[model samples]
Target: MPNIQVSALAPSTQVIRFNRPHARNALSLALLQETATALHAAQNDDSVRVVVLTGDDKAFCAGADIKEMSNTGIPMWGQSERLLAWKTLENFPKPLIAAVEGYALGGGCEMTLLCDIVIAGQNARFGLPEVKIGAFPGDGGTQRLPRAIGKSRAMWMIMTGSLIDGPKACDWGLATEITPAGGALARACEIAQTIGDMSPIAVRMIKEEVLMTYTKSLDESLSLERKLLLWQTHDHNEGIAAFLEKRRPVFSGR
Candidate 1:
């Protein structure tokens, strides 16, 4: 069987599941490669408006495949195929939602950080345990975690290698919502469908502007938003017309 599973929740919402349940869906180089390919395919598919990334009910992901790393070692920074694959995942333009069931540790947690929305099960466990293994999160954990949950909390989690459960994750801002132990995927799909129903141009613009606000100066971000105003898009006019007509708007990607 393939390391990952891709299915459609709806015509516009895609579901990508990590399938390696035996190893708790630990990310191997092969799995990472497969993920990049899947994400790239989704990005280029005009029909795919949203993606919900998930794993089995037992585990979201345990982290990098430790067994593989034991034999081949962790991929080093810069100019590595592994890094390139990660960049592909990071650069996905559409909304990426994470439906986390169980453990989301180390690289797994970092994956959640990459997502625009994270729906975690009540029992889901999140951590960066590399410090316990005499290493640190080699992925974007150091950078993204702090940005997601704030600096001191990230520092405590990383330095102590402690795990935070679902409720804590939500309170810490690491998770957008908390669901029943096995219900994260379903909830995520619902959210994805809601996003899918909106105008694609507006959704993309909102996502881009929000992400940029975190990295760019306030003036630059505001200027960019002004330049990419939704009023300039056909979908915006359609939305207004639909509202006045008391009917649904049919938004074209244009």
Candidate 2:
């Protein structure tokens, strides 16, 4: 089997699984490259409506593959590769969800944080433990972690390298959902399917609006919403008709 497994869960959903269980699904250069390739492919494929990133077996990811880094000698190349991988996930146009189980530490946690949504197994653990190894998370960790879990918590996690489990992650809004053991992927897929069932154009617009609002003041967000809300005019009639008739809304994606 390949180090990374990419498979379709539905006509509109793609699941990419990290297969390096022996290494706790660490982000080796090859694995990061493969993951980026998969994300790139999904971005261009109209058939794919949602993408779920996960790992096989017990561990979600144990961070960078130390063995590969040790062999490479030049750390900058590996660092750059992982950074690219993080950027790919962060900017993926379509909805991305991380289905996390076991450990999601260091680079793993960074990867999960980049996704639009995250579903974690009840036993899943998360942290940025690079400090323990005489380094810090370089792959968008300082930026993404604070955005997700707030500056204080992100700083504490990075500085101490302490792990927090699923419930706490949910409490901090770092995780979208927490499921029973072996249920992270399933729950993630359910959310993906719900998203896939919606109108793609509207879905895309909503994502755009939310991202824009993240940096904008409340007044600016409201002002921008005026422009985007007009998109509803394209399909509002069909949506209402379909809802009243008790049928599926066949969006034209206008």
Candidate 3:
């Protein structure tokens, strides 16, 4: 069976599942490539408005494949297919949600940072344990984790290789929501569907604007928002008319 499985959950929502349960869904080169292919396909499909990433209830992902790493070393950090795959995921324009359960460690934890929203199960555990093995998280963990949580918390996790459970993760700002055991995927899909029902153009723009806040100066961000506000689109007109008509807006993503 394929290590990764992509399935359509709704007209506008897609779910990508990591299928390597035996290894706790440890990331392999082939799996990363397949995931990138799936993400590219979803991004190109106009019908797909949101993507949900998840694994089995036992584990979201255990991180990079240790056995493979022992022989191949860390191929993802350099100019390799895995690096390209990681880039593809990071650059995906549409909304990406991570439904996490069990363990999200090292690269697995890093992957969640790439998503726009993270919904973790009560049993979920997150950490960057690479330091314990004489390695470090090379997949944007050092950078993104600090941005997600505070600097000190991220420092502790990276330096000590300790883990935090779902509630703690949510408190630390690493996770957006915490659900009951086995409910993360369902809650994530619900959120995806709600977002899908809105104006696709607005959704995309909002995501862009929020991400821009990380690097853009305040003046630059305001200028960009002003430009977006002035830009005429069918969705904007539809939204205004719907409010006046007391009805739902039908957006064509224009």
lDDT values for all models: 0.90, 0.85, 0.93
The regions of model 1 sitting more than 4 angstroms off are 70-79
Candidate 2 residues lying further than 4 Å off, grouped into runs, are: 70-81, 232-235
Top-lDDT candidate index? 3
The count of backbone overlaps in candidate 1 is 0
The residue pairs found clashing in candidate 2 are none
**Mind giving the per-residue lDDT tens digits that candidate 3 earns over 11-55?**
799999999999999998888889999999998899999999999
Model 2 residue 82 lDDT? 64
With a 3 Å backbone cut-off (N, CA, C), the pairs that clash in candidate 3 are: none
Off by over 4 Å in 3: 70-76
TM-score of 3: 0.97
Question: With candidate 2 superimposed using the best TM-score fit, by how many Å does residue 243's alpha carbon deviate from the native?
Answer: 2.4
Could you estimate the TM-score for every candidate? 0.95, 0.91, 0.97
Scored by lDDT, model 2 comes in at: 0.85
Lowest lDDT 10-residue stretch of candidate 3? 70-79
